[model samples]
Target: MGLKSFLSRPLAAYVAHQYQKWALHPEAAQQRVLQELLRLGPATAFGRDHDLAAARTAPDFQQRVPVRDYEALSPYIERIKQGERDVLWPGQPLYLAKTSGTTSGAKYIPITKDSIGNHINGAKDALLHYVHRTGKPQFLDGKLIFLSGSPELEQVAGIHTGRLSGIANHHVPGYLRRNQLPSYQTNVIDDWEQKLDHIVDETLGQPMTLISGIPPWVQMYFDRLTERTGRPVGEVFPQFQLFVYGGVNFEPYRRKLLDSIGRPVDTLELFPASEGFFAFQDEPGNPGLLLLADAGIYYEFIPAERFFEPNPPRLTLAEVELDRNYALVVSSNAGLWGYSVGDTVRFVSLRPHRVLVTGRIKHFLSAFGEHVIGEEVEQTLREALQQFPEAEVVEFTVAPRVSDTATEPSRHEWLVEFARPPHNAAAFAAALDAGLRRRNVYYDDLLRGNILAPLQLTPLPAGAFQRYMKSQGKLGGQNKVPRLSNDRVLADGLLRA
Candidate 1:
């Protein structure tokens, strides 16, 4: 190993060991985080307005501040944009993480000096955990490329504003900078296709050991590399050992991705958002992501079934139970109070606060009172894929198809793009429907009552989803096609494609 690789081993071990101190005692760590947030709360307008200074406990804080989405808190955000000091966080934010997918177009999440570490450190620790556990730090000696957004920032009230990934680019550690690939000029290219071409040209012969990006975009890069070199990605980058990904679940693309590489590589899953970096996979074979308990954020949960209720109980870490779906709510040093991140999670291991991202609170199918979550569909697909080993999924989405005619029964429509189409399509569809029926009782009743017809699968061309995303101008950098929708907007779009 080189100097960097040798030094990284001890540093990685120390970081991982330090992290375990908090992860093992989550309730205590969370209490400390809440205390710190409360200490800083009195300095800001939100803190003063919510009477945060008087609040001594999580319940007191919860009673004073109501859970809200971005739209509900935009008034405070607006003041910050107008150069108001202490409107949200103390003084001014270091950066505003720009993201899309809201009805109000882009959302600008505050990244304060106090809270920026949560985003940056969370990513750093994920790698440290991997090196400490697997004892494989040789990747540190070679190029590590992060396929990300343009690092160029736009001014918003004198604050640097851009995609979270872009903002992160400014903070890449000095040590890793030498190993990072795709020159600044190539990274700043606006067109994703052109950017991919440049990246392929830049790294086609480099010693690339680690690749990180959203799975679909990374898959696109893999496709380009193989096509350009007339070799599998493993042959092209023989030293490549790690695939770090976030934004979306990795399972759906797992088979095709590995097939393209022609070998297995260590994969790490992260749960990151504009709001905060919440969790990352810490163990090699575990699907659960270790929640960052002491990472300058106080977490609260409302049972998924009660998420829409007017006064749902906000349960803290001690109150959360295993295997129950909860809507993740967070209050942070970034000045967000009782902010609903729109995600639903299930605690897989309460001892260390490991969770599985089940779905989004707003992203589900309940058009016919048969609520089908993202986890259910993804899990069902996994089960079905196990039965059909030859099948390979590129991407898929589900939407309800409400019938306009009384004689016709409404049904759920699945649009899937296959890298390798199934030999027996009928059997595959049957496996999916059966798996869903077993997992979701409401869907089972709907099927038995004839209220809904069996789900239909519409196969699309190889790159249909990519084409659709490109048309929407969301082709790259943390954008994901919603897995489930109540309306036919996505379904219709895929069908039209």
Candidate 2:
């Protein structure tokens, strides 16, 4: 047997055990996880402050610890950074999963050994669970190329910190190290352009079987490979069997992605973040991902409709209803207590719970009180893009234009950089506007009342958004322009580009 296969035996068995437990008694698994977390560091400052030892139930724990974001957790995290032991986790974090997600500026998220192990093991379970269900392992027989972020980490307050993918790349299993493409030197190139070129050069001749990354970055690699080989991606890597993707909604990029790859391949969607790896598409037939309830995270849900409220009632898995959007809050082995991950999702199934990521709680255009969220915008645009089949959306951002004078009324402005602009701009704009109005009652009401002007669309030059991201040093993996924003910072920057 192959070395990877041999090493995978234990993991496969572990996944099997977890799957059985998840299927039969998921709630029991959650209760056990909570107990473990509470018992781990009960004497630490945070633990004692929250009275973790006294908290015997989920409700009691919630009552003890208030929901907080990174800013609120900064004081404890700072202490952890200053070489303090048993601050958040039992000891110092393995590294920090640095990011600039919903809130502005760089965020240094603590990644304990417990948390990083969960990240790696969660991915293993995803692969093993899929193979067990589908009985397909052709992809495993050949090399797997992960087009991800830089692994060359730098020190942050005596702890290593970098992108989550960068940090995880080092921990790749010894058995599969040979099967992974692109040398470590090539993988750590900081410049996106240089890194892209290096990756293409190094991986062009490899016998790739599986390709994994965020959709947009993967699309870039595929496009570049086609350009270099003068052939389709399927031809270039004929053995390619799987495409693993996450980070953003795939609907907008789906058509172009398939078109670039030149054939259908098995696809798995993951809900992985710096904080935790939450879900994965375990079955090809299931449209939503099976929530990894047994993973290290203790999940909570806040109704998106009332998410902005100062103290909205939260629900546990037993109380959540299907088809309702909720802001995800997680208390994890990572030492993040009652932290909102900024993503929103809705349950598609109740038993053996499965969910679909709907949108981001902060990514919305509601400057004029017409609360238009990322989910609504993405859905509307996906339907609208049907009218322009030949055109493909590359990148897009939306901003609210709050006018102070009556002569210049308020409206939402859309800045789109398309691989192929539509034949008719006016029709595309009209279709997009009509779709939004049809989907959102608040938007329709504003249009009817003339409180907001019809949305405007500006077709940016081909590389405008790319250039902007490059300027900000966030061009590649997991770094993306917020699709909808309440402010004009991103919109103005795109215009300047």
Instruction: Give per-model CA RMSD.
Output: 14.0, 13.8
Candidate 2 Cα outliers beyond 4 Å, as residue runs: 1-14, 102-104, 364-497
**TM-score, predicted candidate 2 vs. hidden true structure:** 0.74
Model 2: how large is the Cα RMSD against the reference?
13.8
Q: List the residue pairs that clash in candidate 2.
A: none
Candidate 1, overall lDDT? 0.87
lDDT by residue (240-287, candidate 1, tens digit) is 999999876555567868888998888889998889999999998899
TM-score of each: 0.76, 0.74
What lDDT would each prediction earn against the true structure? 0.87, 0.79
Reference-based lDDT, residue 94, model 1: 93
